[model samples]
Target chain A: MNKLRETLREAIVEAGVKDGMTISFHHHLRNGDYVLNMVLEEIAALGIHDLTVNASSIFDVHEPIIEHLKNKVVTGLEVNYMGGKVGRAITEGIMEKPVIFRSHGGRAGDMENGSSKVDVAFIAAPCADDMGNLSGKYGPSACGSMGYAFSDAMYADKVVAVTDHLEAYPLADVSIPEGYVDMVVCVDKIGEASRIVSGTTRITKDPVGLRIAYLAAQVVKHSGYLKDGFSFQTGAGGASLAVAKYVEEMMEKEHIQGSFCMGGITGYLVSMMKKGLFKTILDVQCFDMEAIESIRDNANHQEISATRYASPQAKSCAVDSLDVVILGATQVDLDFNVNVHTDSQGYIMGGSGGHCDTAAGSKLSIVVAPLIRARLPLIVDEVLCKSTPGETVDVIVTQRGIAVNPKRTELKELLVKAGLPVKEIKELKEIAEAITGVPQQVKPEGRVVAKVLYRDGVEIDTIKSVK
Target chain B: MKIVKNAVAGTLESSDIFIRVEPSEQLEIDIESVVKDQYYKAIYQAVDEVLKEFQVANGKFSINDRGALDCVIRARMETAVKRGGEC
Candidate 1:
């Protein structure tokens, strides 16, 4: 039977949406996405209230959510990450109910274990057939890898496929099968493709960023884990991508062939696979058009579900096979606990997506950041929020010096012997403080605004409202 | 040095501060910053020190900072004061 609907409103009514129910969306379209706002507006216009929006992540494009949160149309937010104006409002405690923050893996795990319930899930299919078979690789709004939507579609009581491009029945390249979807609604446009995925990402040209990348690459060179069959992951940030560039150069020079690269796949990683440096790319998300093209055409680039990407409940995940992962941090304390969840001012601007998951799973986890950002030092006595625990973090790389976790004495020895500048984490803190001076600790004295959960479903930290 | 006319210096970019000076009956410094919570007192002190160095007591010194360092704050303050007229 056909599952086409006249409009999103019709789909919502047919899906049986009610007050206090939970609705979900995926963030594959990122800042360009129009579906989240569109669906939320429709739900609000229907006079639904006290509903929770369980999104994979929230970006600046979703700033309209602030009005919904204020009007009580949406009272709860459960997300893997939050940023932009919505993040600032959350930190200011606009909603009475605290937002729930989870890692990408933790979110998938919770959905699977029946801990996080979804009443209705709206999947923004870039291309869909009349029967709701979906493909993200064909439409004008195409965003590769419908990875984050799998758990939502599989677990939600009702699933609605929202699409701007509708094809005939039995679509050949189906990313999400018709069995999981219940209704299909056609729209004029789903998102701006340019913003959903970058045409290309550039490596940092800043000298400081280049220096940190060089040292981090050197750390990998001597870590004894950089040889053949290596598996790696890195964030799409400038500094982290710079590290990948250096590592790629070294891999080419040494003729090392890595087994695979996992997690959020970027154009640079696509280039690496094309150059035969890595045999395969296990992509949970695509960061650029190049990655989207690769996933659509190349056999070696395989799209993976978030569960297989990092879920703790999974029998095995790609992160467990990672040899190294390079990450970025807003702040790292003397204990090496990272706070990617908040800024120096205690504002909630980010969250642990797969940060702690990869850090815990990888054999080598390196956090690369500047020692001082503006007038604020990167190393402090305590982080504003502990998004990732120090136990899993192995190294802190900066342009000035690198600090190895005390537990990794052997790794420290290897770096030192290799002529890499190694120093105590405290020493790095001191150096930063000497330049910026001691900034007065601004403790958030208001109520708790959000709860941060580890990939294992443990509450690692709570972010307080900014006073 | 004495207060003269309205003048401005610096920019609103990151690691920088925007400073505006206007002649007034009393010395007043107003600061708006991304790091105001932690660096408010430090920024006030820096501006006060600059005022002392210039020997100007009565002016409205308004600053909009995007986490500028001490050096940046001081330099911008000096430039604004100098551009305000004779010093």
Candidate 2:
């Protein structure tokens, strides 16, 4: 029987959305997503209030959520990451309850274990059939992997697939099976194509960023983990991409064939896989058009569910096998604790998407950032909000120097032996302070605005109001 | 140095400050910054030091900062004061 519906309103009504129920959405569409706002508008029109939104991530384009939050249509937020627009409002104490933050892996684990429940899940399906089979690989608003939406479809009490492209029944390529999705609705569009995926990803041209990338690449080479069949993960940032470039060169020169490259797959990694540097690409989500194209075409580029990608509850996820993962940070303390949740001014502008999960699971976790950003030093007395505990972090690479975690003494010795600039975390902080002067601490005197949960479901830190 | 005309220096970009100077009845420095919550005192002191060095007492100094360092702020304020003074 056909499960297709006429509109999202009909689907929402059929799902029985009620006040205080948790509704879910995924961020595969990134800054271009329209489903969340659309669904919320319908729910608000239906007079739903005090609902908790469990989105995989929130982007600037979801700014309409700010008005919804103000109107009490949505009083609670639980997310893996948040862009600055809603983050700024939340940091200003716009909601009575502090937003609950979880890592990508943690979000999936919580959902699977029934700790964090979702009443209804609205999947922004790029392409789907009347029978409810869906794939994010084809169609106009295609965003590559539908990794983050799997838990929502599987664990939620009701799952509605909102699609712009309605294909025939019994679709061949199904990322989300029909058994989970109860309803499917065709819409004009799921998201803006341009905003969903960047046309291309670029490497850094900045000398400071390039220097940091160089040092980080050197550390990877000497860490004794850059051997054949090693697995790796990196972000889409300029420096992180540049590090991949360097590492690719080294791997090619040394003829070291890697097993797989995982995380938010970028075009750079796709090229590396094509060049025979890696055997496969374990993509959780795609970051650019090239990556989307590769995943749609190349058999070696495989899409993986968030549970298989990093869920701690999994028998053993891909992250546990990850050899190296490079991440970015807003602040890193002398204790090596990393803060990606808030900025130097103690405002909530970011969160731990997979920062903690990767860091905790990978054999070596490297945080690369400039020593100074807009005059604020990177290293500090303590991070304002500890997003990822320093123990999981193995290295901190800055343009000036690289600090190997004291717990990683053998790795430090290896890096030093390679003639890389390895210094104590304290020394690196001192070097930064000497150049930028000691910045005054931004006091967190206001009430709590957000709670950061580690990958293991523990409350790691609490973000305070900006006032 | 004597207050002559309205002048501006620096940029609004991150790691830079935009400074505007105009003749006023008294020394008035207005500071707006992205980092004002944490670095307002340092920014104010740097601007004051620049004004003292130029020895210009009566000007409306408007500083809009995007987290510029002390040295960059001082340099921008100095250039702004000089531009507002006699050639």
Candidate 3:
């Protein structure tokens, strides 16, 4: 039986689109995604309101949701990461309800546990068959990995596959099997493939950022985690990419072969795997075009689901095997509480994508950031929003100095004895203040605008509306 | 001191504040900042201090702060106010 639908509106009606329902979308296409906006525009035109969108992440391209918010066509939002445009509006208290932010793994777990149920999941597939088998690796809009959509396809009451490329039934390869999909809709374009991997994947050239990266690599080398079979993860930030570069050099110099490098896999990590630095790349998501090509061709570059990446409820996830994870922060507190949820002025600009999960599961969670950004201290008395708890964090690396969490005293000693600049977290704060001048305490006056949830589905912090 | 002419100081760069002062019937201060939530009060306080020092009570002061420190904010406000009226 053919599952193909002629248009998105027909698929929406088939999926039973209505007001006040929790619908979901995956962000495997990232900033290039058009399905969410397209579907929402249709739903709004259908006069639907009070719909809660549980997207895997929200990007700058989804700014049309601002007008939807004003019209009360969409009222609730739940996401793992948020780009700056919608984030600024949310910070301004556009919605009466606070946005719910979950980690990548946390979102998967919640879906599996039925805590965050989806009435319908609209998946943007790169290629699919009439009978609904889908793959993200073989079409014009290919984004390489459909990892984030697996749970949505499996758990949602209705699963609609929107694709630009329609293959014949009984496809050769399938990322999502036909059994899980209910409907397939062929669209002119699913997304812009070029914009899927944005420009944030390059290595840093800023001297201060490079210095921090270098020091972070030194800490990883000296902390005894750089031995054989080490598994590592890092963000797609410029400085984090630079850390990978330095670490790759160190691994080659010492001839240490690692087990795996995981997370949003980048070309830098792909090169490391190619050079025999790591035996495999456990990529939950591909961050760049090089990574996409590598995963398409390389045997060792494997795609993993979000649950397999960092689910706390999973029997055992890849993050548990991680030796080190380098993350960036908007603001870090004296206690090492990392705030990736909001900026220095309490504006919603980011969220706990994998920050909490990796930090919680990795043997050493290292945060690297400049001491000051825009003349505002990076290290503060208290983070405006606690995205990752301090206890899970092991070290804080800045251009000026490094601070190991008091709980990681052994790691601290190891770095200090190895001639690294190891100092107290408070001291780092003082140094930052000395450079930027102690900033006045930011007072956010309105109601809470967002809730930062840990990997275990607990609310760690609430972000107040920017006054 | 009565305000003489509209004047502006500083540049719209990080760690700097651009302040402009002009004649007004009553004291008025407006501020826009990158770190607005955290430093707006402090920036307004700095401008008030500078205005009080100059004894200028009836001029409009507008500031665009790009995370400037209190000292830089004060300096820019002082300069702007000085150029606005008799030093």
Best by DockQ: 2
Question: Tens digit of lDDT per residue, candidate 2, span B1-87?
Answer: 777899999999989999999988788889999877667888989988887787888889888999898899989988998889874
Stretches off by above 4 angstroms in model 3 are B1-13, B16-31, B40-63, B69-87
Candidate 2 residue A272 Cα shift, in angstroms, is: 0.3
For all candidates in order, state the fraction of native interface contacts they contain: 0.73, 0.81, 0.69
DockQ of predictions, in order shown: 0.74, 0.76, 0.45
Better of 1 and 3 by lDDT: 1
lDDT (0-100) at residue B36 of candidate 2? 79
TM-score of each: 0.97, 0.98, 0.91
lDDT of 1 by residue, A237-309 (tens): 7788888899999999999999999888899999999999999999889999988999999999998989998
Q: Per-residue error at B68 for model 1, in Å?
A: 2.2
TM-score per model for chain B alone?
0.94, 0.94, 0.92
Q: What is the interface RMSD of candidate 1, in Å?
A: 1.0
In the order shown, what is each candidate's alpha-carbon RMSD?
1.4, 1.1, 3.1
Clash pairs (backbone) in predicted model 1: none
What's model 1's lDDT at A146?
Answer: 89
Residue range A395-429, candidate 2, lDDT tens digits? 99998889998998899988988899888888988
For candidate 3, the lDDT comes to 0.89
Clash pairs (backbone) in predicted model 3:
none
What's the candidate order when arranged by decreasing DockQ?
2, 1, 3
Model 3, A422-461: lDDT tens digits are 9898888888777666677885778998987888888888
